[model samples]
Target: MSSAKRILLTTISASPRENVNYQFNNQVAIASQAPVALIKLLPIHELPDKVIILCTQKLYDEQYETVRNLLLEYYDQILCNTLNQRPDVTEVRIPDGRTVEELWQILEAVLHSIPHNCELTLDVTHGYRSFPFLYFTAALFLKALRGVQIKAVYYAMLESEETEKPIIDLSLLLDMVEWFYATRIFHHTGQASPLCELLRPLETPPAGVTGKDNAPYQLVKSIRRALENVSAAYAQALPLELGREAEQLLRRITQPIPRHMEQKVPLATELFGSISSFAGSFALPATRQRRIRIKEVELNLSELTRQSSIIDSYLKQGYVNYALGMIREWMVSCAMWNQMAEESIYRVDWWIGHKRFETEHKFAVLARTAYKADGNTTRDIITPEQRWLASKWQFFSDKRNQLAHHGFRYEYVLHSPQQIDEIRAQWEELKSFVSSKPHWNLEIKRGQGTLLLSPLGLSKGLLFSALHHIRPDEVFVVTSEESAISIEEITNRADWSGRKYVYKMKEPFTGFAEAKTISRELQNYILKSDRIIANITGGTTAMQYVIQQVTQDLRLTGIETEIIAIVDRRTPAEQVETPYVPGEIIYIEGQGRLNPPPND
Candidate 1:
């Protein structure tokens, strides 16, 4: 029993263009081959049982009246005349095409009208510029949020220059979006499974590139092999083996393609490029060998994420020894590298500073001292809860060291599962503690503190407000290459102690791809942070968007993060009569606050 009902959704246009007139004059046969265009273009099996027209009041009454009459005529006389009934034609009222809020409302109304078990077909034949985009996004939203199956999305190809009227299937765009997401999964996990699944989609490349001898076709096949090799390398933690295969694959990618096939390939080129960029990092030197003191020579955010992901894969597959060592190394790096920068001063003695710290324990002690001295009181910086977490991490480190130096004992290898599980659980708790809000003290000041400012949009308010809320130990101002001057000035003007480090983004943080890249650049700083407070009030929309996403991603890994937009509200007349009362500060936590403080 097929429960699918076909519903056609389209907007009515006010303009009396050639395509509109052509559509109206010929209700049954817009083309010579078929009597009815909608019936001919849409798959016969998926033809609409109901037609929905979205139109503004002005267009519905004046312009859409003619189109509606034509549809009604076709339905009553041509489509269902022999059946003795007319197909349902629903006219959904929409606001005049101007605001995005109006567009959202229109989408909601269309969604509300849709039946539970139905297949959707959208028509972009005659509509405004934003119509197709809005409708497409709505379809995606529905598919994700409501489990709606989008059978097809259509846009009739009728440019003024083109003589033939053809229907263009827009469903392929959504498929490409899915492919991008799949590739992103592969990039993040370094697992060949997701990329291998993409082969099914690439078998039918966009623009009909079905040539077996095509360079892109061959490239994708080669990439599948490369992914397999890289996956194996990750499984074994053999960087050399991965680098050998990756560099060879990269060589094949950069090698001159056939002149004829270059222009024909669109989707394949993008897929290959993304894969190449992700794979290129595997060729880099080991994290241990990389310079921690030199800012530019450090392992980037993406590399760290990949390394962490690789460790997770090892743990999942029961590579307990390898996972433990990697975890210990990363934890040490997080501590010592954090001490390398002044703004990130937390544990190391600010007075004594970093002195080629050989052991992770010494680094921890120094970090503790810095945190203790951050305030006026001589009280311990770490809470008892935090001390417990530290103790657990130390235990994990001890076990890792025993395995490394004394070789694997019976207990280490025999009861590995229980030990690994404990280590993993404690590692998560330690990470949460390290990045939790409790480790970070909130400093209230009028101006000046350690600021992680992004000066993309040339705004100083965010920096000032952020400093006022939390007076950091050191400031790290981040800026795009384009806005480096602006961030430099802010860094110089601010009366923060010690060196002012400015990190530059290679590109604009506008899209998902760019955001991922930007997130990598800010990883170290974010990990060192007790809290990630994203000031979306400043910077370009892209910059603000990526920061919010990065912070959210951090929160997923048990880190505390917040998004704050500074609001400059004028005091009300009645309030202005009284003495000055500053803006009220609000605090919210993932866990509810304790009703009564625990007696220590």
Candidate 2:
């Protein structure tokens, strides 16, 4: 909400060039409203009011008299052009090896000589390394000229083939400038500036939600522009150098032919084989090597031309292939690290319970069971209980996919490091939630037999187990499916000894009427009997059809009864048919009882 305190205008040059004219004009256009100050190592006959002529000690000694005359003429021109509002132009020089702080001290001395009414406008483009110098100088100037507004201009080339571009670490810059400035408006000549092209607006925030005012968009754009310029310059200057380096490497490997060599054909064939082996080892295409040699080498009528050219081409192609492979490998490593960091920051442990644990446990148990069942000598690394826990955990796969694949785009921001940290914290909170809850322990005794329960099938099992701990009763099962042996088989087993159980199968019906009649009769038996156990098996057709008829008959008679589904395994089943409307049951096992006595 703070107002902008200053504006900056700058033009830069290493030496005189055609690009300077465009830079001068662009600065003028951008700074039309603000007072403009030009800084140049050159002394000119004519100058603007706020111009500061900077001369090194070497320049002052070499052209002292001539520079003084030019400075006088420039001062006269500025005085004559504006009758009342004349610009303050000053010429100053500092000794060699002076620190930036010392140079600023001399610059400040010259600025103090000017009238109090004149505001200082710094044109940074013409100075050495103007971008960085101006950035630092502006901070000091703002500190010194407490109330006075300082407008500084900075100009940089989009591409410069003559010199290597300066590498600016933007993150470090962000930290320095974060509090110093209120607002920064960036301008780019679209055609001439790489900064313009690289900084085009994006559709949305790259990582997390971003406000319109965040600094990353601006900083990232600046970095991309700087990198593009560096890359373009490197590409322009380095190809020939790279080719020469490749040729030297080839010469080292192939140039010295032995004086006693007589097996020309065998040697040439062996050279080809060696080249082929190297190419295959590096995963380079034979055809690519052929093309590179054709492009880089000159074939002549010499005796060794054919052999040398082939070897030269292979060496060049090998370099290219190796470089590409390294780049790909680095990119993959970077991407993996980025993913790991994201996962860590997002605290994506919701998947730990849901899917991550499930899949790993399932695989571990399956491997263990498979190994054990196969009668292998390997140790049992995982147990059946582990397998069941894994199955429950596997349900998290969908949740994991939701968190990993789409969570950033839909619900979160990926780019904001702070937000990522917050998300991770939330994930930790969720983990704590899970850790606080009690877990069911499944134990199988040699003679007691095995019991399987899960999030899907174990609700009733949990309640029933708790009930059995308090009061013992013989269990029975009524099921829709016809089995050769029923729940009675387990009840009558040696483990159970003489435990009582009754298993009843519902008769198969062809129509809804017959099915409803059988369901009513089953409901009557359920109400009249002391304890009833049911097996819900097959798909939706059987389960829904039976449940529908039973619920309808129970509602019509207003009879309260408890129905528990006991099953060996669980699978997803669809609702195939609609059930008749019925009042809610007092107890629906596996789901939970509707109401129970406080004592019970």
* Global CA lDDT computed for model 2: 0.33
For residues 1-600, could you state the per-residue lDDT of candidate 2 as single tens digits?
Answer: 224322222222223333222223323212111112222221232233444555456545554445345444544664575553434434466433257786566456444533432343444434444334534555445444644434333333335553322211222232234212311111111111322332344212356646764444444444344334423322332332233333323332243333222121124334423432322221211233534433332211121222223223322333222222222222222222223333353332322234333333323333333333433321233345433433333322333344445354565423255633443343233223222112112111112211211011112232232223212233333333543143333233212322333323344333334445445334213322333333233223443355555544433333333443433232222111211111122234433332232344
Tens digits of lDDT, candidate 1, 302-343? 434545655665666666667777776555554444334455
Q: Model 1 compared with the native: what TM-score?
A: 0.41
Model 2 spans > 4 angstroms off? 1-49, 55-69, 75-84, 91-93, 98-379, 382-600
Deviating ranges (above 4 Å) for candidate 1: 1-3, 17-28, 31-43, 63-69, 75-87, 114-118, 149-152, 157-159, 162-166, 188-198, 204-265, 283-325, 329-600
Worst ten-residue run, lDDT, model 1?
440-449
Cα TM-score of candidate 2: 0.24
Candidates in order, TM-scores: namely: 0.41, 0.24
Best model number under TM-score: 1
